[model samples]
Target: MKVFADLEEFTQAAGTELGPTEWLEIDQQRVNQFADATDDHQWIHVDPQRAADGPFGGAIAHGLLTLSLLPRFMHDLYRVDNVAMAINYGFDKVRFITPVPVGAKLRARSVISKVSALDNAAQATLVTTIEVDGAQKPAAVIESIVRYAS
Candidate 1:
């Protein structure tokens, strides 16, 4: 993990590549839980047996489920130690580029695209790409914003 001494340090390193996070497995249980939480009982995501003959070949994870993994992936990627708190500002752009099949290993690569100073805080824009292991295309691409308060 890359550690920054403070928000200023992180800001100074804007345009830096923070590298990739460790791979995380997207299994059926996780998919099922996400489905339960969101009440998204779509067969493509929750029914393995029926999904075998469906579009993705087998059960696949919900696009939002993969998108929701951003925070976890970012935590594994880097940290700004001097911040008292951080908030997920929002996403500037998000795209579900490819399907994440059940049991697939996924990881994310992040780049600090921009940083701006706010009142007693710093806002950062990060371009994150989540890739499926052994797949040619990324599962998701997002431009995430975060605010770190002093």
Candidate 2:
């Protein structure tokens, strides 16, 4: 993880790709829990038996379920020092390019696109690319923005 004691330390290091987070497995139990919470109990996401005859030949996780893992992904990615708190501003862009199959392992690669001042706080945007292990393409790409206060 890259530790920045101040905003200046972070802004000076733009475009650098931080190391990836630890691999997180997408299991059926977790997917089902997400489905239960969101009322998105779609067959492709929760019905393993029926999904076995579906497009992926097995159940797959919902895109939002994978997207919701951003916090865990970022926690394992990087951190800043001397910041009182950081709030999620929002995502500028997001795309689920590939389906995350059950039991797949995934991680995120982040590039600090820009960091700018916002009154008494600072806003940082990161182009976070999430990829699945052994997969030829990325699973998702998101422009995540956050506001940090000292």
TM-score of each: 0.98, 0.95
lDDT of each: 0.94, 0.88
What's the C-alpha lDDT at position 149 in model 2? 85
Candidate 1: how many backbone clashes? Answer: 0
Q: What does the lDDT come to for candidate 1?
A: 0.94
RMSD of 2: 1.1
Model 1, 33-111: lDDT tens per residue? 9999999999999989999999889999999999999999999999999889999999999999999999999999999
Candidate 2, residue 11: Cα displacement in angstroms equals: 3.0
lDDT of 2 by residue, 20-117 (tens): 88888999999999999999999999999999999998999999987898888888878877778989999999999999999999999899888887
Residues forming the 10-long window of minimal summed lDDT in candidate 2:
7-16
